[model samples]
Target chain A: MTAYTATVTVRLKRGVLDPEAETTQQALERLGFELSDLRSADRFEVDLDAADADEAADRADEMAERLLANPTIHDYEVAVAER
Target chain B: MTAYTATVTVRLKRGVLDPEAETTQQALERLGFELSDLRSADRFEVDLDAADADEAADRADEMAERLLANPTIHDYEVAVAER
Candidate 1:
Protein backbone atom coordinates (compact mmCIF):
# COMPACT_ATOMS: atom_id res chain seq x y z
CA MET A 1 0.00 0.00 0.00
CA THR A 2 1.18 3.52 -0.76
CA ALA A 3 0.61 6.38 1.63
CA TYR A 4 -0.85 9.43 -0.07
CA THR A 5 -2.23 12.78 1.00
CA ALA A 6 -5.33 14.16 -0.66
CA THR A 7 -6.76 17.63 -0.56
CA VAL A 8 -10.37 18.01 -1.60
CA THR A 9 -12.10 21.32 -2.20
CA VAL A 10 -15.86 21.70 -2.35
CA ARG A 11 -17.49 24.83 -3.69
CA LEU A 12 -20.94 26.01 -4.54
CA LYS A 13 -21.41 26.57 -8.23
CA ARG A 14 -21.90 30.05 -9.58
CA GLY A 15 -25.26 31.68 -8.71
CA VAL A 16 -25.44 29.75 -5.47
CA LEU A 17 -26.07 31.48 -2.15
CA ASP A 18 -22.71 31.59 -0.48
CA PRO A 19 -23.15 33.85 2.49
CA GLU A 20 -19.80 32.95 3.93
CA ALA A 21 -17.96 33.68 0.69
CA GLU A 22 -19.90 36.88 0.26
CA THR A 23 -18.97 37.99 3.74
CA THR A 24 -15.32 37.27 3.11
CA GLN A 25 -15.40 39.10 -0.19
CA GLN A 26 -16.97 42.12 1.50
CA ALA A 27 -14.31 42.00 4.18
CA LEU A 28 -11.57 41.84 1.56
CA GLU A 29 -13.07 44.76 -0.29
CA ARG A 30 -13.23 46.69 2.94
CA LEU A 31 -9.57 45.85 3.42
CA GLY A 32 -9.00 47.64 0.07
CA PHE A 33 -8.71 44.65 -2.24
CA GLU A 34 -10.69 44.96 -5.41
CA LEU A 35 -11.75 41.39 -6.19
CA SER A 36 -14.65 40.32 -8.29
CA ASP A 37 -16.55 37.09 -8.87
CA LEU A 38 -15.64 35.75 -5.49
CA ARG A 39 -16.76 32.27 -4.48
CA SER A 40 -16.36 30.27 -1.29
CA ALA A 41 -15.02 26.73 -1.08
CA ASP A 42 -14.41 24.14 1.67
CA ARG A 43 -11.39 21.90 1.86
CA PHE A 44 -10.81 18.47 3.35
CA GLU A 45 -7.51 16.66 3.72
CA VAL A 46 -7.26 12.92 4.01
CA ASP A 47 -4.37 10.51 4.20
CA LEU A 48 -4.94 7.09 2.77
CA ASP A 49 -2.97 3.99 1.99
CA ALA A 50 -3.93 2.80 -1.43
CA ALA A 51 -2.43 0.50 -3.99
CA ASP A 52 -1.49 3.31 -6.35
CA ALA A 53 -2.10 6.93 -7.26
CA ASP A 54 -4.96 5.97 -9.51
CA GLU A 55 -6.61 4.00 -6.73
CA ALA A 56 -6.15 6.83 -4.27
CA ALA A 57 -7.55 9.38 -6.65
CA ASP A 58 -10.51 7.22 -7.51
CA ARG A 59 -11.36 6.50 -3.89
CA ALA A 60 -10.95 10.14 -2.92
CA ASP A 61 -13.20 11.22 -5.75
CA GLU A 62 -15.80 8.66 -4.73
CA MET A 63 -15.64 9.78 -1.12
CA ALA A 64 -16.04 13.38 -2.18
CA GLU A 65 -19.06 12.60 -4.29
CA ARG A 66 -20.71 10.35 -1.74
CA LEU A 67 -19.89 11.94 1.60
CA LEU A 68 -17.77 15.06 1.32
CA ALA A 69 -19.93 17.05 -1.06
CA ASN A 70 -23.44 17.49 -2.38
CA PRO A 71 -22.91 17.22 -6.09
CA THR A 72 -26.34 18.52 -7.06
CA ILE A 73 -25.37 21.98 -5.93
CA HIS A 74 -21.67 21.73 -5.25
CA ASP A 75 -18.56 20.94 -7.24
CA TYR A 76 -15.42 19.28 -5.98
CA GLU A 77 -11.85 18.57 -7.05
CA VAL A 78 -9.17 16.45 -5.49
CA ALA A 79 -5.46 17.23 -5.60
CA VAL A 80 -3.14 14.43 -4.58
CA ALA A 81 0.28 15.28 -3.29
CA GLU A 82 3.26 13.46 -4.78
CA ARG A 83 4.58 10.76 -2.57
CA MET B 1 -0.71 42.68 -11.80
CA THR B 2 -1.03 39.07 -12.83
CA ALA B 3 -4.29 37.21 -12.44
CA TYR B 4 -3.72 33.93 -10.69
CA THR B 5 -5.56 31.29 -8.69
CA ALA B 6 -4.34 30.27 -5.27
CA THR B 7 -5.18 27.25 -3.17
CA VAL B 8 -4.25 27.43 0.48
CA THR B 9 -4.42 24.54 2.89
CA VAL B 10 -4.32 25.03 6.64
CA ARG B 11 -3.72 22.06 8.90
CA LEU B 12 -3.16 21.51 12.58
CA LYS B 13 0.24 20.23 13.53
CA ARG B 14 0.40 16.75 14.94
CA GLY B 15 -0.58 16.42 18.63
CA VAL B 16 -3.02 19.31 18.45
CA LEU B 17 -6.58 18.76 19.66
CA ASP B 18 -8.55 18.18 16.50
CA PRO B 19 -11.97 16.99 17.53
CA GLU B 20 -13.40 17.14 14.03
CA ALA B 21 -10.53 15.17 12.63
CA GLU B 22 -10.86 12.62 15.37
CA THR B 23 -14.53 12.20 14.68
CA THR B 24 -13.93 11.77 11.02
CA GLN B 25 -11.17 9.31 11.71
CA GLN B 26 -13.44 7.26 13.88
CA ALA B 27 -16.10 7.32 11.20
CA LEU B 28 -13.66 6.19 8.60
CA GLU B 29 -12.43 3.39 10.78
CA ARG B 30 -15.97 2.27 11.43
CA LEU B 31 -16.50 2.21 7.70
CA GLY B 32 -13.86 -0.55 7.52
CA PHE B 33 -10.82 1.62 6.95
CA GLU B 34 -7.90 1.19 9.27
CA LEU B 35 -6.34 4.61 9.59
CA SER B 36 -4.20 6.31 12.19
CA ASP B 37 -2.87 9.73 13.08
CA LEU B 38 -5.56 11.53 11.20
CA ARG B 39 -5.35 15.30 11.05
CA SER B 40 -7.83 17.79 9.63
CA ALA B 41 -7.07 20.52 7.14
CA ASP B 42 -8.92 23.40 5.57
CA ARG B 43 -8.56 24.63 2.00
CA PHE B 44 -9.17 28.10 0.60
CA GLU B 45 -9.29 29.18 -3.02
CA VAL B 46 -8.45 32.78 -3.86
CA ASP B 47 -8.18 34.71 -7.08
CA LEU B 48 -5.69 37.52 -6.93
CA ASP B 49 -4.07 39.90 -9.37
CA ALA B 50 -0.49 40.12 -8.24
CA ALA B 51 2.68 41.31 -9.92
CA ASP B 52 3.94 37.75 -10.13
CA ALA B 53 3.61 34.24 -8.78
CA ASP B 54 5.94 34.91 -5.91
CA GLU B 55 3.94 37.96 -4.93
CA ALA B 56 0.74 36.02 -5.10
CA ALA B 57 2.15 33.20 -3.00
CA ASP B 58 3.51 35.66 -0.48
CA ARG B 59 0.21 37.46 -0.19
CA ALA B 60 -1.65 34.17 0.10
CA ASP B 61 0.63 32.93 2.81
CA GLU B 62 0.18 36.19 4.65
CA MET B 63 -3.58 36.05 4.31
CA ALA B 64 -3.64 32.46 5.52
CA GLU B 65 -1.56 33.38 8.53
CA ARG B 66 -3.36 36.61 9.36
CA LEU B 67 -6.99 35.85 8.66
CA LEU B 68 -7.63 32.32 7.49
CA ALA B 69 -5.91 30.45 10.29
CA ASN B 70 -4.64 30.63 13.83
CA PRO B 71 -0.95 29.99 13.36
CA THR B 72 -0.26 29.23 16.99
CA ILE B 73 -1.36 25.65 16.42
CA HIS B 74 -1.71 25.46 12.66
CA ASP B 75 0.59 25.44 9.63
CA TYR B 76 -0.34 26.52 6.12
CA GLU B 77 0.93 26.08 2.57
CA VAL B 78 -0.08 27.76 -0.64
CA ALA B 79 -0.22 26.26 -4.14
CA VAL B 80 -0.64 28.56 -7.13
CA ALA B 81 -2.11 27.30 -10.38
CA GLU B 82 -0.27 27.88 -13.60
CA ARG B 83 -1.92 30.63 -15.60
Candidate 2:
Protein backbone atom coordinates (compact mmCIF):
# COMPACT_ATOMS: atom_id res chain seq x y z
CA MET A 1 0.00 0.00 0.00
CA THR A 2 1.10 3.54 -0.65
CA ALA A 3 0.67 6.44 1.71
CA TYR A 4 -1.96 8.90 0.55
CA THR A 5 -3.71 12.06 1.69
CA ALA A 6 -7.40 12.36 1.09
CA THR A 7 -8.93 15.82 1.26
CA VAL A 8 -12.63 16.25 1.79
CA THR A 9 -14.23 19.66 1.40
CA VAL A 10 -17.71 20.21 2.79
CA ARG A 11 -19.84 23.25 2.06
CA LEU A 12 -23.40 24.26 2.67
CA LYS A 13 -25.55 23.77 -0.37
CA ARG A 14 -27.10 26.71 -2.14
CA GLY A 15 -30.19 28.03 -0.34
CA VAL A 16 -28.91 26.66 2.95
CA LEU A 17 -28.69 29.11 5.80
CA ASP A 18 -25.10 29.78 6.79
CA PRO A 19 -24.94 32.11 9.76
CA GLU A 20 -21.22 31.64 10.01
CA ALA A 21 -20.60 32.88 6.52
CA GLU A 22 -22.93 35.76 7.05
CA THR A 23 -21.11 36.77 10.17
CA THR A 24 -17.80 36.53 8.38
CA GLN A 25 -19.00 38.66 5.53
CA GLN A 26 -20.17 41.26 7.96
CA ALA A 27 -16.80 41.26 9.66
CA LEU A 28 -15.03 41.81 6.35
CA GLU A 29 -17.32 44.68 5.56
CA ARG A 30 -16.63 46.17 8.96
CA LEU A 31 -12.94 46.03 8.12
CA GLY A 32 -13.44 48.24 5.06
CA PHE A 33 -12.86 45.44 2.60
CA GLU A 34 -14.82 45.23 -0.62
CA LEU A 35 -16.58 42.06 -1.74
CA SER A 36 -19.95 40.94 -3.01
CA ASP A 37 -20.65 37.67 -1.19
CA LEU A 38 -18.92 35.10 0.95
CA ARG A 39 -19.38 31.42 1.74
CA SER A 40 -17.59 29.05 4.04
CA ALA A 41 -16.66 25.38 3.88
CA ASP A 42 -14.87 22.74 5.89
CA ARG A 43 -11.89 20.81 4.63
CA PHE A 44 -10.59 17.58 6.10
CA GLU A 45 -7.32 15.93 5.15
CA VAL A 46 -6.92 12.28 6.08
CA ASP A 47 -3.68 10.36 5.83
CA LEU A 48 -3.75 6.64 5.24
CA ASP A 49 -2.49 3.83 3.07
CA ALA A 50 -4.34 2.71 -0.01
CA ALA A 51 -3.80 0.61 -3.13
CA ASP A 52 -3.84 3.72 -5.28
CA ALA A 53 -5.17 7.27 -5.55
CA ASP A 54 -8.58 6.19 -6.80
CA GLU A 55 -9.06 3.79 -3.93
CA ALA A 56 -7.97 6.48 -1.54
CA ALA A 57 -10.52 8.90 -3.00
CA ASP A 58 -13.25 6.30 -2.68
CA ARG A 59 -12.52 5.81 0.97
CA ALA A 60 -12.47 9.52 1.54
CA ASP A 61 -15.79 9.91 -0.24
CA GLU A 62 -17.29 7.32 2.02
CA MET A 63 -15.90 9.16 4.97
CA ALA A 64 -17.45 12.43 3.85
CA GLU A 65 -20.82 10.95 3.07
CA ARG A 66 -20.97 9.24 6.43
CA LEU A 67 -19.61 11.85 8.83
CA LEU A 68 -17.84 14.78 7.26
CA ALA A 69 -20.97 16.34 5.80
CA ASN A 70 -24.67 16.75 6.36
CA PRO A 71 -26.21 15.71 3.09
CA THR A 72 -29.43 17.64 3.47
CA ILE A 73 -27.60 20.91 3.86
CA HIS A 74 -24.09 20.30 2.59
CA ASP A 75 -22.21 19.27 -0.53
CA TYR A 76 -18.82 17.65 -0.36
CA GLU A 77 -15.95 16.79 -2.68
CA VAL A 78 -12.90 14.57 -2.35
CA ALA A 79 -9.38 14.72 -3.71
CA VAL A 80 -6.42 12.37 -3.23
CA ALA A 81 -2.67 12.78 -3.41
CA GLU A 82 0.53 11.01 -2.47
CA ARG A 83 1.65 11.54 1.08
CA MET B 1 -13.86 46.48 -12.03
CA THR B 2 -14.49 42.96 -13.23
CA ALA B 3 -16.36 40.15 -11.51
CA TYR B 4 -14.18 37.67 -9.64
CA THR B 5 -14.40 34.82 -7.20
CA ALA B 6 -11.88 34.45 -4.39
CA THR B 7 -11.24 31.27 -2.50
CA VAL B 8 -9.59 31.39 0.91
CA THR B 9 -8.61 28.23 2.72
CA VAL B 10 -7.85 28.52 6.41
CA ARG B 11 -6.04 25.75 8.26
CA LEU B 12 -4.56 25.23 11.66
CA LYS B 13 -0.86 25.76 11.76
CA ARG B 14 1.35 22.74 12.30
CA GLY B 15 1.58 21.76 16.00
CA VAL B 16 -1.63 23.65 16.74
CA LEU B 17 -4.35 21.85 18.62
CA ASP B 18 -7.38 21.00 16.50
CA PRO B 19 -10.06 19.61 18.74
CA GLU B 20 -12.55 19.53 15.89
CA ALA B 21 -10.31 17.44 13.67
CA GLU B 22 -9.52 15.17 16.62
CA THR B 23 -13.19 14.69 17.31
CA THR B 24 -13.91 13.92 13.67
CA GLN B 25 -11.04 11.48 13.58
CA GLN B 26 -12.42 9.69 16.60
CA ALA B 27 -15.79 9.39 14.92
CA LEU B 28 -14.16 7.84 11.88
CA GLU B 29 -12.39 5.32 14.09
CA ARG B 30 -15.64 4.45 15.81
CA LEU B 31 -17.04 3.59 12.40
CA GLY B 32 -14.27 1.01 11.89
CA PHE B 33 -12.40 3.08 9.33
CA GLU B 34 -8.62 3.13 9.43
CA LEU B 35 -6.53 6.23 9.10
CA SER B 36 -3.28 7.71 10.28
CA ASP B 37 -3.95 11.40 10.83
CA LEU B 38 -6.75 13.86 10.21
CA ARG B 39 -6.62 17.58 9.75
CA SER B 40 -9.39 20.08 9.11
CA ALA B 41 -9.54 23.45 7.39
CA ASP B 42 -12.06 26.12 6.47
CA ARG B 43 -12.52 27.39 2.92
CA PHE B 44 -14.25 30.59 1.93
CA GLU B 45 -15.41 31.57 -1.54
CA VAL B 46 -16.10 35.24 -2.15
CA ASP B 47 -17.71 36.66 -5.24
CA LEU B 48 -17.03 40.25 -6.23
CA ASP B 49 -15.68 42.57 -8.87
CA ALA B 50 -12.07 43.54 -9.43
CA ALA B 51 -9.90 45.28 -11.99
CA ASP B 52 -8.15 41.99 -12.68
CA ALA B 53 -7.53 38.55 -11.25
CA ASP B 54 -4.30 39.71 -9.61
CA GLU B 55 -6.15 42.47 -7.82
CA ALA B 56 -8.77 40.01 -6.72
CA ALA B 57 -6.17 37.64 -5.34
CA ASP B 58 -4.43 40.44 -3.50
CA ARG B 59 -7.66 41.56 -1.90
CA ALA B 60 -8.50 38.02 -0.92
CA ASP B 61 -5.09 37.57 0.66
CA GLU B 62 -5.71 40.66 2.70
CA MET B 63 -9.08 39.31 3.73
CA ALA B 64 -7.50 36.08 4.89
CA GLU B 65 -4.87 37.85 6.92
CA ARG B 66 -7.22 40.36 8.48
CA LEU B 67 -10.49 38.61 9.16
CA LEU B 68 -10.80 35.15 7.64
CA ALA B 69 -7.96 33.53 9.60
CA ASN B 70 -6.45 33.75 13.02
CA PRO B 71 -2.84 34.40 12.20
CA THR B 72 -1.70 33.09 15.58
CA ILE B 73 -3.07 29.62 15.01
CA HIS B 74 -4.27 29.53 11.43
CA ASP B 75 -2.74 29.84 8.00
CA TYR B 76 -4.69 30.76 4.90
CA GLU B 77 -4.30 30.85 1.12
CA VAL B 78 -6.08 32.79 -1.56
CA ALA B 79 -6.94 32.04 -5.18
CA VAL B 80 -8.87 34.18 -7.58
CA ALA B 81 -10.61 33.59 -10.88
CA GLU B 82 -12.77 35.62 -13.21
CA ARG B 83 -16.38 35.51 -12.30
Q: DockQ of all candidates, in order?
A: 0.47, 0.90
Predicted candidate 1 versus true structure: per-residue lDDT over B25-63, tens digit per residue: 677667666544355677677888888899888877777
Report, for every candidate in turn, its global Cα lDDT versus the true structure: 0.75, 0.92
Cα error, candidate 2, residue B58 (Å): 1.0
Provide the lowest-lDDT 10-residue window in model 2 chain A: A34-43
Model 2 interface RMSD, in angstroms?
Answer: 0.8
User: B19-43, model 2: which lDDT tens digit per residue?
Assistant: 9899999999999899999999989
Error of 2 at B77 (Å): 1.0
| Clash pairs (backbone) in predicted model 2 | none
TM-score per candidate, in order? 0.80, 0.96
- Per-residue lDDT tens digits for candidate 2, residues A1-66, read 999999999999999999999999999999999788998998899998999999999999999989
lDDT of 1 by residue, A1-83 (tens): 88888777888877779888778767767766655435557777778878888887887787777677898889889888755
C-alpha RMSD (angstroms) for model 2 = 1.0
* lDDT, candidate 2, at B56: 90
